[model samples]
Target: MSFVRTLRQATAADHEMVDAHYGGFALDRQADYRSFLTAHARALPAVERALAEASDLPPWRSRTALLAADLHALDAPIPAPLPFQPGAAAERWGALYVIEGSRLGGQLLARSVPAGLPSAYLAAHHLPGEWRRLLTTLDTHAAGQGQAWQDAALAGARACFALYARAAAIA
Candidate 1:
């Protein structure tokens, strides 16, 4: 299987758990919207920073600022980011997978945001073919690496999901 498929399979439970947690927040309400953005604010920055530090991946536009702006528009306090540091190249790829994948869901979630609410974060999406490019990059990277690397990537994705879940619980 391609690395993207492998990673998705490995993280299926984690992804569902995150979705359930975030789904509890009804984005139609301003208060729930604030909490939702707050939850994301608590996790996204650290992950983005870690990915940036990894540095070998393709250029990524950080959504941290967009997330922060959404919160600021609501007059909501931006929570401190949860700590996340991906230690290996494969691990970083895993973390990036979770982060980037969320954008796909965000496009759908943006509709839940009621009229007049800031949705720049949810509206921010990868460019056309960007996701395919990312998948290709992951598969290429995994092609030469052994099972240990794949395992690390799985672990990294799980860790990232855990961070988001934690943030949701707190929010």
Candidate 2:
């Protein structure tokens, strides 16, 4: 099995826990949707900023900006700025793994959004081969890891999921 697969299995419980906190696709009101976007806005920029600071990775478009646009279109206030400290390079990759993987699900979530609502964040701008690139990068990062590096990366990914859970509470 590839390291990405291993990482997925290792983090499976955390993934399920985070998903449980997000009120699902059955939202009946625009208010619920706005709250959901606002919660995402609160959490994503921090993770993105940390990734930016720690790695020389080429830019993938910022979902924070996309979320802000959707929030504005919905008349929801943008979330206030939050401080996010950068992590080590390996840790940043781990956190990024969660963020980037969400784009795949965002494609599905975008389908369920009400017709009249803005869905730019879910309708992420496509970059050909982005997921494959990120997966290859992650696999390479994991290739030579010692237990300590693996631990740090797992912790970073878990921290990201926990951050979203906290944001979900506020939403």
Candidate 3:
């Protein structure tokens, strides 16, 4: 099986749990929207920082500023970023998978947000074909790397999901 598919299958439960936490927020309501943005603010910055520091993955624009802009528009304070430091290249790839995958959902979620609310973060969809490029990169990295790399990737993805879950719960 392709590494991306394998990773997805392994982390399905974690992804679903994180979705449940995020799905509970009613984005139409301003307060709920603030909470939603707040929850993301708590996790994304830290993850992006860790990725920037640890990996030489393909260049992708950071969504941290976009998230901050959304929070600023809501007059909601950007919460302290949750600490996240992926320990290896495989682990960083795993975290990146979670982060990039969220953007697909974010596109749909952005539509439900009230018309006047800021959604730069949610609306920050990948440039054309970006997702495919990322998947290719992931698969290339995992090719012949064997089970140890896969395990680290799974651990990284699970840890990332937990971070988002924790941030959501706190928000």
Candidate 4:
């Protein structure tokens, strides 16, 4: 399939996976609602960079704004450390919604200087190979065949699922 088409496919899949991650924890724990987002304090930049680097947008100003709005939906307090119980479906889905929206906006307005991804994705966090694989796919799509975003987004979205699954070690 065309890479652009692949990116959109990845976006749909991205939405679904985010939903699933929230769903999994939502069933038993209320704490999980916020736990997912706690990391976003750092990850949001990653997301923004993913979009910004791709679209050449400025770094996220008020990165916490998106996260805070999502947190408001939950009844539970912000999560603490490990041993957190993922929250109810309502909670998990809310966070996922935030991610989708942020990603969507980033994808929409994004205009990167270069066709390829910035160094952070592979370096800083050094996402697992699975994640890197998708980034690489985006890289290929970005650098390849006229340079595209739609294709990169979908591919990146699909890759995000694998990362989430890997983190959870879900079969």
| Number of residue pairs clashing in candidate 4, backbone atoms closer than 3 angstroms, sequence gap of 3 or more or interchain | 16
* TM-score (C-alpha, index-matched) for candidate 1: 0.97
Candidate lDDT values, in order = 0.91, 0.79, 0.91, 0.38
Better of 1 and 4 by lDDT: 1
**Candidate 3 versus the native: TM-score?**
0.97
Q: How do the predictions measure up, each by TM-score?
A: 0.97, 0.91, 0.97, 0.36
Best model number under lDDT: 3
Error at 123, model 3, angstroms: 0.3
**Local accuracy of candidate 4 as per-residue lDDT tens digits, 1-171:** 644344445467565765565445431233543454443333443443344333332122334455545455543333322221222222222222234444443333223212332212112221235333544544453454443344333344444444444433321
13 Cα displacement, candidate 4 (Å): 3.6
- Tell me the lDDT of model 2 at 144: 79
Tens digit of per-residue lDDT, candidate 1, span 119-171: 99999998999998888988998888899998998889999999999999998
> What are the per-residue Cα lDDT tens digits for candidate 2 across 1-171?
777887899899989987898856254368888888888888898888787676445456678888989999998899864555546566776788889888887887888788889998988945888889888877876887776777777788888888888887777
**Using TM-score as the measure, what is the rank order of every candidate, best first?**
1, 3, 2, 4
- Residue pairs in collision within model 2: none
Q: Choose 3 or 4, whichever is better by TM-score.
A: 3
Model 4 residue runs over 4 Å out of place are 1-6, 27-30, 49-55, 58-62, 65-153, 160-171
Q: What stretches of model 1 exceed 4 Å from their correct place?
A: none
